[model samples]
Target: MLSTVLLRQLTDQVQELHTTAESQLQPLPLPVLNFKPTPGSWSALECLEHLNRYSRFYNAELTTALHAQPQTATPHEVGFSWLGRKSYDTVRPDNGKKHRTITHMNPAGSQLGTEALHEFLQHQKCLLEMLAAAQGTNLNRKAVRIEFFKLLKLRVGEALQFVVAHEQRHLQQALRAAHQATTAPILVV
Candidate 1:
């Protein structure tokens, strides 16, 4: 779970990524980045496509969660430290966790075109807006998850941390995909 401070930090990072990544995203040389040396390899387009897919998923989850009342009280404040690293990269040992696979049900992700980036931006903005609404006591409230990972349910603060951490994980992947672009392709903001 995330503390209030952590949520704020994550929100700031999300905004930063929006600016930096957007500034770099352009479509003039799409085919170069789309090239795959091997059949199993992922191209830049596919990477962005997956991010867009999860962005939609998370957007729906956040919107659905907002309607439910917390079983407990909400929190208004928490503390965070620095924002000195890149996105939360799960594969990195410093990230302190084993990497997990992200599902890609749609094999046709590359064909989505510019709509993929637009979806990602829209979802990120929507997520930040929802996070804003959860300020005040909502931060401390007990969040209701359809399925709790452990015996006890996560508090709202914890949930936000999970959300931010998860987002940071994906954000890192999106950035990593940039490396795989054929000609240093930019992802459209």
Candidate 2:
């Protein structure tokens, strides 16, 4: 089961993510939203699309985990395996370092309209709901399958941390893209 402290921390992070997405991303003009620093880099929309891809997998896993068993009032402390901890650290936002995206998570350069932001917002809301539902759920013991690797699994709490951190990283990338646009005024404030 998830501890009250961990759940509160996770909820706060999710709330911050939602607020950032709404304020920084949703109000941008289309051209600015779509601006990419270079041919190879992702635009704000693409960054969000990339996040949507991961969220699709995670939200499903979280929903399943929530319904998989009954929750308890007794809280369990969250811990991660060495590999999981390392993976979580690596995904955290650090503008100085850029990691190559796996093919599956990479967004195509296709033009995404405002609907992309709406979808991303929806995903964020789902994540918040999942976090709340996970309050008394066994986050450490219950494994959620990773989409990238069939055999790899992260405990529920670890997965939540990774997903939230990954969102922050990409959101930073998106905000950077917005700020760096030459064709449009900065939309991030």
TM-score of 2: 0.90
Best by lDDT: 2
CA lDDT of each prediction against the hidden true structure: 0.53, 0.83
lDDT of 2: 0.83
lDDT of 2 by residue, 82-104 (tens): 76787788888863677888887
Off by over 4 Å in 2: 182-189
- The candidate that achieves the highest TM-score relative to the unseen native structure: 2
RMSD of 1: 7.1
Clashes of 2: 0
Clash pairs, model 2 backbone: none
Backbone Cα, N, C clashes tallied per candidate: 13, 0
RMSD of each: 7.1, 3.7
